[model samples]
Target: MSTFTKPNHIGRKISRIRELRNMKQEALAQALGTNQQAVSILENSETIDEDKLIAIAKVLGVTVEAIKSFSEEGMINYFNTFNESDNNFNHYNTCTFNPLDKLVESFEENKKLYERLLKAEQDKIEYLEKLLKGK
Candidate 1:
């Protein structure tokens, strides 16, 4: 016998994935062309029909196998990873530096340069007015 444990509660797994996706029973029911009461009954059961499971998976934007193997630990890990990213906006897995941060920095520098150029123009206009008055 294998020591690995598998999640077998298909209905509860579907419910959990739906909840994680921020979906309500009524919304899921609407997508599945069923009523909320029927969805409730399905979620409360241990097994679900394969056809219904396929429909539910499509509605939930997940695979049928994912629904069958969904676990609380996996959900928790996903949230933890998401929260870590939420806490640090600069952290992106694809690159060592955030391009958005660089863009914002470049924008600030350009803003300062534009302000300086505008001030210089104003100073030139003031000097021209002063010279005109003295002439």
Candidate 2:
């Protein structure tokens, strides 16, 4: 039997990318025609086979190398380097105007709209009660 080597920091990168893509494990599994538990295990750095890794990379829209390129120190150093950069404001400005930001803003607006709808329903119920009591 062949031994499986655990990927270095790929798990963290996969988790981060999944979040960035706004994907649930179940959704990703569906995209890959697999099961959520398998996706969870992959994200959590549990034992995984190469075929699973390839499927995940395809579903995540990233190269397998991109997923596997992360070293423990490399991950930390890359993030730290970005943290130390003075261009964060510029980067944030660019990201704020991205299509993803529009989607996020739209989602927030929908949430608010749903909240208002619920409140209106409650108010209507109260009004109907007052009318029934002739108040």
Candidate 3:
């Protein structure tokens, strides 16, 4: 047997997600183009408008569903799962360039810049010598 139930305290869920993202109510209010007091009132309410919820979720860098289904224990469990080495997987990890190649590229760029500056200084010295000889 299975049961269907609706989640409660949607506003509190939004608040929890915001806090987890290291955001303050005032910051969220700024993102929403409202004010801190409005944010406080929103956090204290039971329900939030759908459009505003979407806006808040975007500002918090999360999906609306994430805020809707958020719970403290669930978040902790999710983080713990990542801490276990066995669960670590490189499913989508890709590197555009090898680290050694990147280092070589950076060194080459710096070498080119140094060469250009050295040539400039040499040219300036030659120009000054020519001016003194003419005088």
Candidate topping lDDT: 3
- Local error of candidate 1 at residue 39 (angstroms): 0.2
Model 1 off-target regions past 4 Å? 1-7, 81-135
* Candidate 2 global TM-score: 0.44
lDDT of 3 by residue, 15-104 (tens): 888888899999999999999999999999898989999999899998989888888889899888887754346544666679999999
**lDDT by residue for model 2 over 1-135, one digit each (tens)?**
999986465667788778877999899989988889977777888445678778888988887887777455676887788668858757766643579889999999999999999999999999999999995
RMSD per model, one decimal: 7.6, 16.4, 7.7
lDDT of 2 at 46: 40
Residue lDDT tens for model 1, 1-135: 779875488878888888889999999999888899999999988888899888999999999888887889987898799777874766444587899999999999999999999999999999999999999
Cα deviation in Å at residue 37, candidate 2?
Answer: 2.2
Off by over 4 Å in 3: 1-7, 86-135
Candidate 3, residue 115: how far the Cα is off, in Å: 22
- TM-score winner between candidates 2 and 3: 3
**lDDT for model 2:** 0.80
Deviation of model 2 at 25, angstroms: 0.8
Q: Lowest lDDT 10-mer window, candidate 2?
A: 88-97
